[model samples]
Target: MLGLLSESEAREVEQVVAAYPEIKSELNAMEDALTQYAVAKGIPMPADLPGRIIRRLETLDKDVPPGSTTPPQTDSGSGPILPILGFLLITALAGAIYFWFQTDELQENLNTTQTELQQLQVNCDQIQDSLEQIVLSLAVLRSEGNQTFIMRGLPDKNPGAVANVYYNTQAQQAFLDIRELPPPPAGQQYQLWGIGASGVPQSMDVFNIPQGDGINFIPVPYLADVSVFAVSLEPAGGSPSPTDVHMISG
Candidate 1:
């Protein structure tokens, strides 16, 4: 009992407790001292002291084996589980990153493919338009044996402009060939007219020609006794009637 112990013994026990690296190892000895001290003093044990001794004993028991004083098993399988779980976590994280990069690459490729497809579609449309123009040009050249009229631009209005008219009398088709003209201003276009025997101009077709390379071929379904061919400047899509005389090749 601590109370029964001489002052030197009590001091010695305290010194031993202080000398130990782990305070948890002194719980049993501390409890023994408290019990002997309470009995020797003819006093009941303090309520707080039992609870404190139990808590300290529990802490020491976690690190010390039962029946023997050797330290408890430190390997609770936690070390192995941690490393394995960490490896699995890292693997999952890497897989997610790889998938993200792969998805981005696929999306970029898809966008590129879509752009190329759109350009191809535009090229196809242009090729189709050119083919139609070629077919019309061939039809006009085949009618070369028919009555051909050379309509020179009016020297006063357009000195450098020239055009040709091919009339297939057998087929009753008129083909117009404008060889020289200036480019129309923005929002304006050129229209062709057939002047008949009665001097009345009939609406024929509308076309646009680039500067320097001013040739255009247009086919007319109906051919009457046309004496002259003319051209006029109209709106972008042409008008029901000529707006102004830009160039007349007749």
Candidate 2:
């Protein structure tokens, strides 16, 4: 069809097409497809194309010797122009659909980034609070009248947990340094207790572990004549009496 075949090959193709009507029909369909492709790609074609083809047919008839089989050329009309316009419309619709999806994806990504930034801010605030607690605890420990005591974990419950209690008897200031303790159970917190000489437990402070890893330096109420410092796992706000004693120091 593209004039790529030799003379002998062209003759053979012509004979085959003549013998098979289905082959001729398929070749005609291929010519129409090529014409549509050319128009869609903006390839220019002369308006007098039919006239040029008729003249070429006349020349071919004269050039070919007698008794030689001549292959017929398929005529492709202005059928390709309408299909080219349809192709352009489909392309425009596809582009619009792609743009809508891209916009939705970008919006989702922006939402994710904003959520991550909010989490980061919350982490930063927690870090600041922890730092303030550490500074206050350090000041209390370095004071002149400060007394330090080591609270050992109960063997039955938490043998590895330990706490360092710092108290200033003159200033009535106290801080509990949690050196090694596992996180509390869900919906629970650690409660600090001050046991006086009378053997009654007084609730000093109740606190929770922050989200990330860090040493907790918590300030607690200092009781006068307190002989023992203890910690217990209790409900969120703490229990009046020691409900679950885990660590104790005198």
Candidate 3:
């Protein structure tokens, strides 16, 4: 018989232990309180206390009693089933921890995969755009009688550098093939211009030659007549007026 805990002490212990979400864990907390209470009162714990506790726990487990089940009748409030409930609480806590870590790992992996997929999509779009531009360029060349103009690079620049200009007299379109020309320096680009006999230059098209084998097409506006075609080096997007003539051809 355990009557070591005072009435007030027993009430406090019950309230604290019952606050747990799992009543089974509360049962174990009650057992610990009882053991401490007995020791403080100079009462030795019974030798068969563990065996009695296991037997009572087995009965309660078989019944699958509700969380609100009343404590088993005993001389004191402490019951033998408390130890078993504590073991069950520890097992549940361990399982919850394992699941939480597993879920976090899965989320991290999903985020990594999503990032990779987005990068792949961007690469695919760039490739598709390049292919479309190439197809359009070829179609324009085949549709008209194209006059090829070899635009020779100007002096003070790299020699042997040249660009091919395909002028379609009927369609009045110019397709520039800069595949043979070297890449422009940083912050600079090649801009095409239509040179009139009056020595005035009209903005035609401004474009860049891509890193490898670049080709581009520009629709030539009908200017009635033009003396020559010119290319100038300007800022990246191109200047409103020609700065320096890089190459010229008639």
Tell me how far the alpha carbon of residue 40 in candidate 1 is from the true structure, in angstroms, after superposition. Answer: 81
Tens-digit lDDT track for model 2 on 57-129? 3444565566644433334544344334333443443355346446666776898999999999999998898
Query: Which lDDT values do the candidates have, in the order given?
Result: 0.61, 0.68, 0.63
Question: lDDT by residue for model 3 over 95-172, one digit each (tens)?
Answer: 553454466667768989999999999999988878888898888768766677678887786455677677776777
Candidate 2, after superposition: displacement of residue 198 in Å? Answer: 5.3
User: For model 2, how many clashes?
Assistant: 0
What are the clashing pairs of model 3? none
Tell how far residue 145 is off in model 1, in angstroms: 5.3
Off by over 4 Å in 1: 1-81, 186-189, 205-216, 234-250
TM-score of each: 0.55, 0.51, 0.57
Q: What is the lDDT of residue 171 in candidate 2?
A: 88
Tens-place lDDT digits, model 1, residues 15-97: 33333324334335545664675567455544575675465444445644445533222247333343343334434433553
- Candidates 1 and 2: which is better by TM-score? 1
Candidate 3: stretches off by over 4 Å: 1-81, 180-189, 196-201, 211-227, 235-243
